[model samples]
Target: MTAPASSRLGIYCMLGGMFLISINDMLIKSLSGGYSLHQLVLMRSLVGVFFTLFMLKMEGGFAVLRTGRPGLHLLRALLIVFANTSLYAAIVSMPLATATALYFASPLFVTLLSIPVLGERVGPRRFAAVGIGFAGVLTMMAPQLAGKGDIGWVMILPVMAAAGYACMAVLTRKLGATSRASALAIHLQVAFVIVSLGVWAVAGDGRFAEGTDNESVRFLLRAWVWPETGDLAAIAGLGVMSAVVGYLMTQAYRLSRASTVAPFEYVLLLYSLFWGWSIFGEWPEPTVFIGAAVIIAAGVYVFMREDRVKATRRT
Candidate 1:
């Protein structure tokens, strides 16, 4: 079906949410040097949980927590937790652009996996898009595959995460009106809390290893530093912005189809590129750009094809 006039707004909202999410990832990566991924995930989840609960309460009473598909909700939450945790690991081990590029493969994975999982029809166009997307990935991986840095295996994490994320998106749509978005977000946070705590407990030793005095260490310490009055205001601004962005994102999915909205998520790649350059002075090499371009183009084609199909239906 063609999207409703109201659903059009969700496009912009989702894009904006993707932007905020990218910034969040960039910030975590910028600080990934001194602090472990476990710490970052734990803190982000803690902050997210605080706001998610409030929003859930305001939107609906605690009854929002009750849903027919509680098992599916928990399963979706676990998938997201796993996806994000793997993504964090990939970010710590790989280049920002590369990691983001690989993760962007989720849409293509969704298209491919839908055939089996959802019994969705797939035509030649989608098949081509999925194929080209993988080619783009191979383009990006060529260097790592042949070069000295053999940490190439880390790339699998984001790919796996992307697959899992796509599954979560599929499940989200299946959920229909059985649960509110706010409640779903809360469940995700709950799962994240359990996973993050587990990681911190097991691998927490020496992550914030002492006496390093590196830029990463400085960044972490700066997080704790009591900012001057101006800096304090800026910090407060970001926190509020984070919550606002988070809410808008929740609303986006609540209002639109996952396939329709998920493609615009590629916008995060542009944001990742910006932060990668600004914060780390790490511009991806030419091959990386070539690969990223192909991947993005394939994604765009898929999204466009979906639009065409929807438009034809409207006609």
Candidate 2:
């Protein structure tokens, strides 16, 4: 495919992936009250594994799953697992819009990591953008930082999640040259299964259990109960949504330059805002809007700089 066409496809795919992910988060948050996080993840991963295997069979065969870079795939999977756990924990208590806005920092994290990890030269323009982006983060976090609001330390979880996701995004680009998108998706789902099961086993013993008043702790340590029929169906739907999300996002980074497609991820904040209001009747505060606008501006500036750099090289 031509570079222009490939980049367009990558952006569209990313939008679709983000939409599905937003819906998945909405459903997960709705069900978080009745189910443990581990149970939710485990059930979803179990269904995702089957969906992946079926997709593999229909596409070609199991042969596509074979990979020479097992170590890299393992590392990517581990990073995604950490990202999932942290973000899920955060959203259980925080509004979806707030969590999504905080998670948008992932692109900035990617730009910063690319300098050292990929040996890419970041000029003054991009450096300033990164600094501004971080300042936006601090702005959104100011209430908690000043100990004025109830958000407290749980506000940091989404930032941790974004960092893990940034690392995984870089690794996805590195592995894209050699790995099939199916292989990457399957590896991540498998990792989710393993990690969720381990947590379920350990936390079931009462070691992690504390009090139910705290949403984050409740999500982590709550015992699993049998899900209602409606919730079970919703959980199954989440599996399908996640499978689609994983495949499309992997293809997004694999098909074009990450910088070219990264900005479209801001669409997620829009989707999250809709779901937050429609489903949960939650809305972001005025400060969050100001902070999100600053972060989005900084992220767009960084991408524009990268595009200029690429254009100069081509010329």
Distance from true position, residue 305, model 2, in Å? Answer: 1.8
Model 2 deviation from the true structure expressed as Cα RMSD, one decimal place: 2.7
Q: Write the per-residue lDDT of candidate 1 for residues 89-111, one digit (tens) a residue.
A: 67655667778988888878877
Candidate 1 Cα outliers beyond 4 Å, as residue runs: 1-11, 148-151, 206-243, 253-263, 310-315
1-315 per-residue lDDT for model 2 (tens digits): 456888889999999999999999999899988888889999999999998887777656778877888888898899998898899999988889999888888889999989877888899889999899989888999987689878789889999999999999889878877766677778888898998888877785445666458898888788877789878889999998888887798789778786778788899999999999999999887778888998999998988888889889899
Candidate whose TM-score is highest: 2
Residue-pair clash count for candidate 2: 0
lDDT of 1: 0.72
TM-scores for every predicted model = 0.80, 0.91
Supply every candidate's count of residue pairs whose N, Cα or C atoms clash at under 3 angstroms: 0, 0
TM-score result, candidate 2: 0.91
Error of 2 at 4 (Å): 7.5
10 residues in a row with least lDDT, candidate 2 = 204-213
